[model samples]
Target chain A: MGIYLPIAEISVNVFVLLAMGAAVGFLSGMFGVGGGFLITPLLIFYNIPPAIAVATGANQVIASSVSGVLSHMKRGTLDFKLGGVLLAGGIIGSTGGIYVFAFLRRLGQLDLFISLLYVVLLGTVGGLMLVESVNALRATRSGAAPVLKKSGQHNWIHRLPLKMRFRASKLFVSVIPVLGLGAGIGFLSSIMGVGGGFIMVPALIYLLKVPTNVVIGTSLFQIIFTSAYTTLVHATTNQTVDVVLAFLLMAGGVAGAQYGAKAGQRLRGEQLRALLALLVLAVAIRLAIDLFVTPPNLYSLSAADLN
Target chain B: MRAPNAFATAVVLSLLAATAPAKAQVPLTEGIQIGLSTDNVSITAGFSGADLTIFGSLENPDPLVARQGRYDVIVVLEGPPKPVVVRRKDRVLGVWVNLDSETFENVPVSYSVATTRPLQDITEPNSYKQLSLGASNLYMQPADAGDSPATIEEFTAALRSRKAATGLYSENVGGVQFLSQNLFRATVRLAPNVPVGTHKARAFLFKSGVFIKESSAQLEIRKSGFEQSIFRVAHNYSFLYGIFAISLAMLTGWLGRVIFRKD
Candidate 1:
């Protein structure tokens, strides 16, 4: 008996699906990333519609993050309190973002909007990271401090109403601020159909000034929860989750993440950031070009109506 | 901290930038091409079409290459709105077997399919649905009510009979047929005992055990003037677009930090 999938037009093999999962898993593991950025694009390249790709990527991310989160927990690096604060904000933001996501999709403006944003963000981020990391390397060689010396000054997040102390994460932040941050991150996650942990982690570290050690752990905790929620919602609503596909990708991702984490350990913090920045920039530029440039194949067909 | 050193470094950087050149592109003309035409021959429902040729750069152009082991193209067809069913058959020991397209479902219709080349592996197992008249069991239409224009049973029988005689379908109802070695036709023949109305058709092609191409068309099977309609309702739509725009901005912000933000 044949299993019927809602989306049509292409019938791919189980092995091919697994290989795609493996490729994305390797990249995610290597970078300590959620892999949605790359996975969505690759899926689109293979003719999977964007809506399905984003929803399905959320499913795969839950499993991909398992091994990475476990290792972080084992090292006693998690800051559950801080993660909870951000997650609260993110959840609200995601709810709002979903509304926007569905709206844009119906209007057929999703691709253009996504591409433009990627271009601006990627180019700026890549350029800045490359410059900073290279400068840090030069400074180190010259016997200068890698980071500028400064008073441990507080940021705006510290000044908001309803202050609460987070003992494990070493933070005494305002509840309102945490909620606001979570809301913003949540919105992005929902709209982009990505985990948004990469952004949330940095915000916690630099904006909130949480210590470096807790940054990854906190992000993973939040990611685990948010993605689980997203997966359940999309599965129940759109029936988009394909456990077979997700499992294949997860198997590859877990193995890749182990190696990636090890490799990450060997690189200097500045060097790693610089390399990652370059990669982000490249993808951003490619996406931007796609938006502005006329496509080679101008006419296409979608099999969605076949149902 | 020295002025001379800074000036020297700037010169070196400028020189490096000037020396870099754009990478070379691969030209498409360098690739070889091949021509293909339909090889006339029909395979019964139990068989597959077995004539196809490629007059291009064969890796080994020797005529003995046919027996020395080579690839032969097979054209297979199924149902209207053609779900592509074709594949490349690798010849071994003078017999061609479709290594592609491995699965078949449903059991209906009586069938027979004949081909010019000897099939490599041919068997009629309970699980295997034959490509010939036997397929009518599945393709056959359901019985209609009394005084109905056409009954499903009569439609399947008529199509089955036509297929047995000429390997060509005249009615516009749904059935699978192979026209030539390189070309296959999947048609939807309207049953003589059925009602009159518009219907849809589809076709698909396969290569190397995977579906490679497909096409679909909507045709009115009725004998009447065409009916068409288009409705557009415009309302407040920018809110969603605005949200997408903002979400993208946040992603960009996050990406920017990822690339440029200091750790």
Candidate 2:
């Protein structure tokens, strides 16, 4: 079936979009990520304009994040205070990112900038996760316990001024790093159409020393609002959000997510992380290749300064 | 004197007789007229490219010339004009970047041409340039005239080729056929991504490779369907639309979790 996307002003196969969404959703569920990072690039590869892809990806992230957050809320692993502080910074950063997005679009460099950001960020994050997971897996196979970071170990981040205690995570951390991390993720969310979960989860674990149990829930909690804000801004300013496209993806994503979550339970954490790392690395490599390869058509046309 | 006067009268009579057929040989100037059944066409969401048939007539056409296939007609459907920027990507530090750009003002969003014969066979290329009849002949005015002629020419060629590739600018040979000496039907293409605005349908008449007359009509191509309504809402009431989109996402998320809870 074919459906016309109002904002994108194009007709795309409904089944292709649904399947793309389902595949991304399955991975997101299996990996406990928002899936925005995957969807935006996939949409671009599928020939959706990068601007619309980014905005619509942000819109679709809300559904998966909300679904994930609900499970976390029920389990009582969510840190509301930390999530709230992150959200405060996210709104500000997202606002700035939207301006930059519009500016780059006008300059006709938004696509390049988006691809570059994805390649750099995803490649680094994926590489680090792969190495860490492989080491952990090796340790387990050798009948040795995996070395864990002590929660009480003090880092420079803990020394920062104006520290606030997060009761749920059982930690006192400076508001500055928390707010800064939130702001960075927020920026990425608006610009890259990602919930920044891949970055946020690891950052929370290593940088902020947030407890592993509460990290995913708290990251997801903040991601829901940040992406929601990003969607609203892109909609109002760029008018690029295609609800029809977003809806189809969400429908497929939500259904696939449930089954994926069930399937994920059978896998060990290290194996799951390794698989997700490979997936991320693959996407990053794909995007990087496009940047270097010669495009068939060098000349492109667009409406001049669409108002 | 009588002989001379009679000779003069006879000469005058002969002159009048000789000039009579010459005066009668004057051909009537041909005129063209096109009419549309409706001023507006509403295209639904499933609108792929379709051929629009326009009925027209040649007024005061000479039967002898029409029979010889000397009468040619070219019909063009031009969409609304808008400013467009064409950018060229250049390899920089192993990455392709949009490095150069040229902007053209009042470029037609779409132009589709239908002709009784091939454009080259119907008339001289100079005539096409003079009338700006075909897509290739249509002048694209650069916003910055200060740019070098070579650069402007390059960009203009690029723009036209890109438009042609996208099916926005097209030419159909023998798309116009004469039903009778005076009546003709033209079939012009409307691309799937046709711009929604007032489109101008123009027909040009040629007699023996000479420009005779031209007629034009206006058509409003509107996208009318559920998708169009959503587009309107998104642009007109963007704030509310944004809120709605967010709410819809949240609803879908909550519902999906409720319906398909794994734990």
Candidate 3:
């Protein structure tokens, strides 16, 4: 079925959009991520204007993050204090990012900047995850115990001033790093339309030394609000959010997520990580190729006004 | 009846000549007029592209010239004018980037033409240019006239070709047909992505390859449906719309978790 997207001002196939959402949702559920990183680029590839794709992608992330946060809340693994601090920083960072986004759009350089950011970030993150997972897999195959980082070990981050205790995670960390991390993710969320979970999870685990059990939940908690804020800003300032398009994706995504979670339980931890790493690498590589390749049409037209 | 009609025409012609004796041998000048059934057209969400047929007539066409197929009509439907920027991408450090741009003011968003015959066969190119008729003949004014002429020409050609490729600017040969000696019908195309605004429908009359008269009418094209309403709300009440979008997302998320809980 065909449906018109009001904000995008384009007619797209309903089934194609639904299927795209389902596929991304399935991956997000299997890998325990918000799926925004994948959806925004996919929308661009599907011919949605990059501006609309980024804004609508942020809107879609809210549903998935809320769903993930609910499960964490039930398990009592969420760290509300940490999430709150991160949110404080996120709002500020997201505000700045929105201004930058608008400026680049007016300069007609937003598309290039977005693709470059995706390729660099996704490529590095995916590369690191793949190597780590593969090493763990080899250790298990060779009948050796996997090496683990001791939770008691102290890092330079712990030495920062003005430390605050997070009771739920059983840790005392500096407010500076926490706020800065939140701000960084918030910036990425608004500009790239991602939850920044792929980066946030690892940063929490390694840099902040946050407990593994509480990391995902806390990350998701902050992600929900950050993406919600991003969506609202993009809607009010740019008027680029296409609710019709976002709704269809959410419907398919939510259904696919449930089944994906069940399927994920059947896979080993290292194997699951390895698969997700490969998927991330694939997206990054595809975007990188587009940057280097020649486009069919070099000349394009737009309204004189940014709208 | 024919004899009396001819005599009355001669008497009127003589009276007209006596009043303005500069040219005494000429008959009444041919004039064209077109009419529309409605002043506005509302297109629903499912609107793709459609052919709009306009009915018109010649007021004083000579029967002998009409019989010989010398009277030709060219009808055009011109969309609302808007300022547009054309950008060109250049390869820089192995990445394509938008490097140069040109802006044009008051350029027609779309132009669709319907002619009784091919444009060249109906009249001289100079006449088309003088009348500023047809998509090619329509002048596009640059916002910065100080720019190099070569660069302006390049961008202008690019703009027209892009418009043509997108079906916004089109030409339909033989789309206009004479129903009777003085009556005619013209069909122009409206593209799927047609801009919503006031469109001008113009008819040009030609007698034996000479421009005679021109007439025009106005039509308001508007989008009307559920989608259009949403668009209006998003732009007019943006803050409320943003809140609504956020609320909808949250609702969907909460509902999905409850309905499809795996644990």
Candidate 4:
């Protein structure tokens, strides 16, 4: 029942790992999320080192995003022009993030830093999303269609330079905002192991006003390359990515996502958003508590002490 | 970057130190027959912890030393070396954070010692230091040894306690039990978390507190089957391995869509 992870150098139960992958996959399917945020924290909670957890989580994201993108491609929904611009920034940002990751690891503050970063990021993102989704749900219940952000609305993003036309999304917005958004997500991808869908899909819908139909596909496309780059960086530089652990997770994740995609059709947009908001908030709350709570083992030992 | 392991460091140092040879003394490897239960240990997925029994015989020909009970047998096992970093956590804004740290380079990843009797009772301080009989007597130099404010004593204490806690570095004073007048066997416990590499097991024979012969054998602990292939690919060809991982994931993702179909 136990499988040894070659890179992680530990033995974990195969069934338990599969079940965990299924649980996270189910959430991703239900909420249109990558579940990296959930899985990485769970791995860390189980005593897997933060470095390995983050790297392997990114590896899984590459799998999830690839399949998600393929389905979108079949439907001809991806905005390749838009995805390309973002990917250019993403690659650059991720490469830079790895150096920062290596530096923090050497100083032995990577673990604490990762936890605090998650607490802050998840708290802010989850809190804002929950408030917005709750109000949108309330509007739907009152027999009013929740209003979607309209295109061509003048904003700060519109005023930026380096304008480019994205034919598929039918947007002529400036490339600056797209690049910045891509860079931010790419930076987070290496450190946090997320596909950045939770952040990206929402940004495309509101900030860039991309068509909702194409937003998910475009985000997945960008995620595929970004996380793949992150995986390579971690493997070559930090030597932290565990291929065996990633393989087990992807096996369960790919299968579970099929069921998840089918289940997603049953819910209304606002209802689904509401559920996702609640789930994100719950994870954020858990992280917050861990930060404030006194850890059982304050002193951690690392490196080697053979003699 | 994945730092070079302790074995690599030791080999380089030993080669350099050999050129500037130390004091001439009786080499420790006199009349001893030693065997490990399995010289090459294969670590499969089912590997937890293992017990390594070092069975050896000593040819104690000197009758006077045996009559006086001045003969002892010490068996030691050492894993490949790597740097160890120990840090003290301080409360910063109510969240614990690592502040000060000391790094000890070229220390064994794991070291286990078993002897017929207590190490201290068998040898004097000068003799023990020269032989490196005890764990504390290792030549583990702190990176900041000569620097101000970073004491060697503090770093070594942290290193010793931490390794002891993990069962990596241990000492069994009476672990080496004798089956007969010239035969002895000792069991050294290795934790599951022990690093995988070439380990060294050494046995020393002493008489009347003078230097004697020592015999050493190699113990190869490597990942077996699929784990072996995976470990080699990851560490050896990491860049290609990364690409392979991504490709495999993408392939599975695509295969999933093909098999499951749109429901």
Candidate 5:
């Protein structure tokens, strides 16, 4: 069955949307990454208008991330102080990102820019994860322990002034780099229509040396806020948020995330990471191919009033 | 009875000529009149596409003017005008980028034309240009003044090709089939993406390479049902709609979690 989306002004199969949402949500729950990076590209490939896809994709991220955050809340793994600082930066970065989006859209370069941004982000993140997971998996199969990077080491970030203590993560670090990292991720995710969880989880672990348990939950906490802000900004400014499409996706996404979190517990960390790496790589490779290959038709039309 | 009717029409024509001086250019509809299959179209939530049929009838008051079924009728449907921006891409650094662009204001968002025969077969090129009566021939008003003629031509061609490619603009020769002696019908398919507003449906009567009579009708295409309400809310109360959208997302999330709790 299909329904018409008023904001997108297109009729689409509701089942297809639900399936996509479920698939993305499952992957996100298993890997602890927001699925906007997957959903936005898939929508674009399906010929949905890029603006509508991006805006509605952000809305879906909010739904899945909220569910993820709630589940983590009961476990007491989230660092609210750290998440608060990140959210403060995200709000500022998202505001700036919307203006940049408007400028690029006015120049008719938004599609090209969005595609290029995805190619770089997914390519780098996917490439790093693939190499690291492969090594970790091999070490595990050989009955060898993989040596993790030393945590809580005195890094350059500690030298900055205005140090603050994060009781949950048990770290005392300057807030400057933390805020800047959060802002940069927020800017990228908002413009790319993601939740910044992929970048946030890794950055928190490596850059801030936040505990692995704290990273996933705290990242999701910030994502819920950032994605929600991005959705509202796109809706008010661009009027591209398709509430009908968002709801349909969220319906399958939230349910899928619940089951996926359960399924993740059955797999080893190395195997799960390996699988997530493969999934992210697949999306990255697809986007790269689209950029490199010649399109069948070139000319396109846009209207001032359209999103 | 024929003599009395002709005399009365002449008297009425004289009176009209004295009262309406500006309408002297268009002759009184002495040849053809058009009636649409339906003038008002409501695009409900389930609307995918619709066919607009124009049924035109030709009448010859003067026996000497014997055109028979040779009269070619071309019906053109032009949607409401909106500003459209088109960007042309070029290969730069082995990647395609939008290097040049043009914006055309007051351009019909959708234009569809159907005719009894080929456009060239029915009228002179001069009249075709003067009337601007075909899908490809719609006049484009360039938003920028400094653009050269070459750029204007390029932009106009790009606009026509893009709109035609999307089925928003089209032309089909022999689309208007004559059912009988003086009756004809033309069907124009309005794609689902057709701009939602009043569309001008113009029917032109051409006989022996001369424009004889023309009549224009308005067909309204507007959103209805659930779709209408959503579209209105988004455009009218955008901020409120945004908040509502977020709230909806959160609600669905919470509900999904509650329903599917493993514990």
Candidate 6:
């Protein structure tokens, strides 16, 4: 006699997950930025369980950044000294962020806070970055060098004592200012389940006046540290990190990064920034739709009692 | 034009049929009539006694409607049967007291208990049944009635084995209790391994060597979020992480070059 299996026993499409991963990977490559602004929300859209989705996204970031970091290092663009300083603050800030995240989870308000932050931060930044990049591209086509802005203009930050020279990034900024920036980025990274590269890279280039060459390296270093710590912490505390899942994503990410870097080489800085800005705007819009649109399923299982 | 209109109508009809809930007209058990007294004195069924008595009403005149099936009743002469087991050990005073005896054993007269069937068949409830033997001997025998002398042993054994085979994960949703002689709570705990679906539970009471009353309850178990967690992590995490890592890498590399550009 033949045994029959029930339909529910079969799994849904796995390719959906792989396709989403590839799409996010393509955007991340084109923009030269982390797409947590997009990836995390997409996971939720696909009905992935939130905690596992956040933890797994962190794992994927680790893979995605490795090749990008290597390419920047090879280009003599990586500022190791400044990267180290920003990283120290990022580590402390991320640790604090984890505590805040855990506290929010206990209060049962983490998802609300995360969604709100995504909408506000991603929307504003995406719009501003897009407009600025388009202007830069227009300016470049007219044969003018895009003038980089100075960060020490803020009198309050400039007035702080203990100024330090960042030789590789070619700036002399106050240690307090750098530390404050690092800490803010770290906290955001930890709480939002992101490495905060998209946020930090701009803050470094515009807020702190770190040379563009140093921004990616420093951000990558910080992300590598924060995400590794976040992954380990989530694993030990929530038992959320699954190594098998991490490895599979890493496999795809590493290859994707290589291809992305090659494509990035052919793009002018202004063109790349404009494209990235558009991508971020698109992701931000998609997330807004998710938040405001009517949900298909009104009744859902709570996280605490899923069974 | 007519064909296109017909196709659109067919599509609309199919969509409505697909979304509508299926009809739910399954009737409750059709053949059994079960009733229990509130005081737990007796359980009476319509179809168990040897001779049927049809009580007549002048106004209605159709007595068969009132007593169409056999009636089986469970009765306790005094109250519920109390089994007491006493354990005896010699004390330092050279007199042994039965420590294992239940409080019921203190009453000194032998009680002749008449039941519907053998002691084994009466043990229908799923919970552990405590049987006690005391100084006074207790005897149980089936009454002589029109009921057959116990060909239902096979059925009782099947039920007992099924009840005993339930695994540890099973939930005991129905309660078990000896409310009185004729009443027992037929308890079944829904098992964790049970799929999210509907299940049926049956409880039967026997007396005087015949099947008397059978009662049943339906249980519905629904799948919840915990099950989804296993699927999300087990299947979805890898792809999620893959995309996140790649985007982060690109962001860092591009921004690194721009920030580091020389004056």
Preferred candidate (lDDT higher): 5 or 6 = 5
- Writing each residue's lDDT as its tens digit, candidate 4 over A19-40 gives 8887887778767778888889
- Candidate 5 scores a chain A TM-score of 0.96
Worst 10 residues of 6 chain B by lDDT: B52-61
Off by over 4 Å in 1: A1-9, A13-17, A148-151, A297-307, B1-263
* Residue A156 alpha-carbon offset, candidate 3, angstroms: 2.9
Give the range of the ten consecutive residues with the poorest summed lDDT in model 6 chain A: A1-10
lDDT of 3 at A274: 98
Candidate 4's fnat? 0.70
The candidate that wins on lDDT is 2
RMSD values for the candidates in order, in angstroms, are: 27.4, 5.9, 2.5, 9.2, 4.0, 24.3
The segments of candidate 3 whose C-alpha lies over 4 angstroms from its true place after superposition are B1-27
Query: What tens digits encode model 5's per-residue C-alpha lDDT throughout B88-150?
Result: 887888887888888888899888888988888888888988888886667888888689999
What DockQ, on C-alphas, does every prediction get?
A: 0.01, 0.65, 0.70, 0.39, 0.59, 0.02
> Is candidate 4 or 6 superior in lDDT?
4
Interface RMSD of each: 17.8, 1.1, 1.4, 2.6, 2.0, 23.6
Score chain A of model 3 by TM-score against the reference chain A. 0.98
How are the candidates ranked when ordered by lDDT, highest leading?
2, 3, 5, 4, 6, 1
- Candidate 6, DockQ to 2 decimals? 0.02
Which wins on lDDT, candidate 2 or candidate 3? 2
By TM-score, how accurate is candidate 2?
A: 0.95
CAPRI band for model 4: acceptable
Per-residue lDDT of B1-263 in model 6, one digit per residue for the tens? 85456456545554665676242211211133222222111111111111111111111111222132212222211112222221222232332211211111222111112222333444433311222211111222212223343422322232223323432112222133333322333323322223333433333333223443444333333333433443344345544533343455445435433443221
Candidate closer to the true structure by lDDT (higher is better), 1 or 6: 6
Off by over 4 Å in 5: A305-307, B1-31, B37-39, B59-67, B179-183
